[model samples]
Every structure is written in C-alpha cells, then in structure tokens.
Target: MKEESQTIRTKLAKIRFFSPEGFFVCAAIITVIFVAMEALGLRSSVAVLAGASPGAGAPATLGMACLYLLGYLAFVVLAPIFVMGSIFLLLVNLITGIFRRQQRHF
Candidate 1:
C-alpha cells in the first residue's frame, strides 16, 4: 500500500504545465470545473450575457454570468486544443525518440 501510494504521488508530481501529460491534466481540470459550475445551476447565469434578466439583481447576476462565461468559453475553446496539443506533442516525441535510436544504431 505504501509503495503504491508513493508511486501515485511520484506520477502526480511528474506532471508539469509544459508537458503533454500536464496539458491533458489541465484540460481535464478545466472541464471538471465547467461541469461543476453547470451542475450547480450556474448555466442560467449565462442568460445575462444575452441581455436577459435571469435573476433579480442585474449587476450581480451579470457579474456571475460573465465569470461563468469566461470559464465556459475556456472549456469550450481551450480544452479541445489542449487535448490535441498533448497528442501532437506525444507523436513528435515518439518520432524523435525513434529517429534518435536509429541514428545510434548506424
């Protein structure tokens, strides 16, 4: 159990923002955040973005809507890009590694 837990910790520690795995993790986090907010009924707050009064207070609702909009937009736009980026980076790394091994054999 201890060894397994330590290995999990080490794997988590290996993820950095600039790495492919880290990008996937970041995308996952962003998607989870968006899902949580949606589950909490924050999606209605987005009505403020369309000039509709979904709640009593315009300013407060608008602010919340704006914040939610930013997060939603980030998830919609950035998450897919991050996933693609991770795949692209993984492929590039694999190709380079293969070439390096071939060169060493020659």
Candidate 2:
C-alpha cells in the first residue's frame, strides 16, 4: 500500500503542468492571439457591440457586426469552460476508479 501511494505521488509530480515552463508557454499563446487580433484590426467589431463606438452606425448599421462579435466572445468564453469541465469530469472518473478498485481488493 505504501509503495502504491508513492507511485501515484511520483506520477503526479512528473505531469509537468504545474511547472514554470508550461505556464510561460500558455501565456505566450495568449499574447500571440492578442497581437494577431490587433494586427488584423478585428477589435473594432467588439468595441462597437460593447458600445465603445456609438457613431459606428452613422453610415448604416449592419447589425451583423454585433452578432459576429457576440458569437466570437461566446465561443472564446465557452471553450475554456468546456475544457475545464472535461478536466473535472476526468478527475472525478479517476477518483471513482481508484475507489472502486480499492473496494474490490477488500
């Protein structure tokens, strides 16, 4: 039992996700996305919907622009929520598996 506990601890340590290297890689990805958005001049759509630019409709409001921005933000927010939810589900499954296996041993 002691050996099994040590093995699990070692496996957790080796996952590397908690390391500084992994953190910086994720930060770099986020930075790149922001830079690309600025370069592409795509931020105007979000600004208009958020009412940063009310005169953006002076020529004629497309209405589609705000819809696109809403969709984009919804997708961006939902992606991480979905990913985290899946990770939580995976951890729950792992814990349940361990408990079931231990019960079988008894």
lDDT of 2 by residue, 5-26 (tens): 9998786556454334334334
Candidate 2 regions exceeding 4 Å error are 1-44, 47-55, 58-61
Instruction: Name the candidate that leads on lDDT.
Output: 1
Q: How well does candidate 1 score on lDDT at residue 89? A: 92
CA lDDT, every prediction? 0.88, 0.58
* Candidate 1 residue-wise lDDT, 30-100, digit = tens: 99999998988888887766667647457889787878998899899999999999999999989999999
Q: Which ten residues in a row have the lowest lDDT in candidate 2?
A: 18-27
Error of 1 at 22 (Å): 0.9
Deviation from native of the Cα of residue 55 in model 2, angstroms = 9.5
Q: Provide the lDDT at 82 for model 1.
A: 97
For all predicted structures, in order, the TM-scores are: 0.84, 0.44
